[model samples]
Target: MNIIQKTDDELLEIAIPMWDDLIKYSNKGQYGKFIRNFSYNLLLGLNEVEVGKQFAKSELTRSLSPDYDVLGFIRRGEHVSCLFRVRSTKKEGEWLGRMVLGYEKGEVKIFAASVF
Candidate 1:
């Protein structure tokens, strides 16, 4: 199925769990699980050592709250960008998290994921 063509509810059904897993794995510093759904290019830009460094240095990343609000969704070309209101378990406020989804090898995958 083309993820970009999916309904908002359908897309959320797929994305939310992946987002949850990303948070879960990140909190545990599990690089492999955190990036398991990432696309090939996305994974190419990251490595275990670099991710470990991030897990060690970024308190916010390490303390991400699993519960997040879906801010919105944007569809462009073959991708769907999921915006989220993310919070840190140890911090006071929220951050914007973006997870861009697209097809890779005929399977759904995260093209990019970031928080700011």
Candidate 2:
């Protein structure tokens, strides 16, 4: 992985927040802003409602909803692999999600994501 020479503070304060914003917009059902952060394929087979339902992101705005933390990312050429920790008080209290990001047309977009 070709790591980006950035401070944790920068990743936390800048890069990570960008991904967080994607989820925030997703949870709010704002397809325009939400879809902009994703890569082509991830956005291709899904619509706004499906994206919300599939990710269970619609409930993310609730006070008792799970918290998402961007652990970090490893960059390889134009690809960036991100790790996130999802914490909740429910039965599935803690879990991990992996996001594969890549630079396409000069934009860093999430190409894939999966719960682990």
Candidate 3:
């Protein structure tokens, strides 16, 4: 599912079912492991983003770490995309965007991602 533009509620609805399905078929290796890991990590990242947004709204200025629970790596084109949630209080408080980390040639890269 494309989660970039969807609200948290929408994402949760889609994600939970996918996660459950992954768990149901987890006995298979490789593919099963990948699905489970991806679903788990994605959920964790979403939660972190939500919490971070709340903290930002409360005007908490502490450095917020990306939620690792839902954070994960995926191969995209020639690079690996590190998918995670990002928060910026200055814009509007709470979570701001989806962070994507990719490799450019041989160097690390970051692409501000949006789901549509």
Taken over the whole model, the C-alpha lDDT of each candidate is 0.91, 0.60, 0.37
Worst 10 residues of 3 by lDDT: 23-32
Using TM-score as the measure, which candidate wins? 1
TM-score of each: 0.94, 0.61, 0.26
lDDT of 3 by residue, 84-115 (tens): 44443233334432334333343333333331
Clashing pairs in 2: none
After superposition, candidate 1 runs with Cα above 4 Å error: none
- Specify the poorest-scoring 10-residue window by lDDT in model 2: 57-66
TM-score winner between candidates 1 and 3: 1
In candidate 1, which residue pairs clash?
none
Among these predictions, the greatest lDDT belongs to 1
Ranking by TM-score: 1, 2, 3
What is the total number of backbone clashes in candidate 1?
Answer: 0
Clashes of each: 0, 0, 6
In model 3, state the lDDT of residue 96. Answer: 31
Task: Evaluate model 3: give its TM-score.
Answer: 0.26
Candidate 2: RMSD over Cα atoms? 4.1
RMSD of 3: 14.3
Q: Which ten residues in a row have the lowest lDDT in candidate 1?
A: 42-51
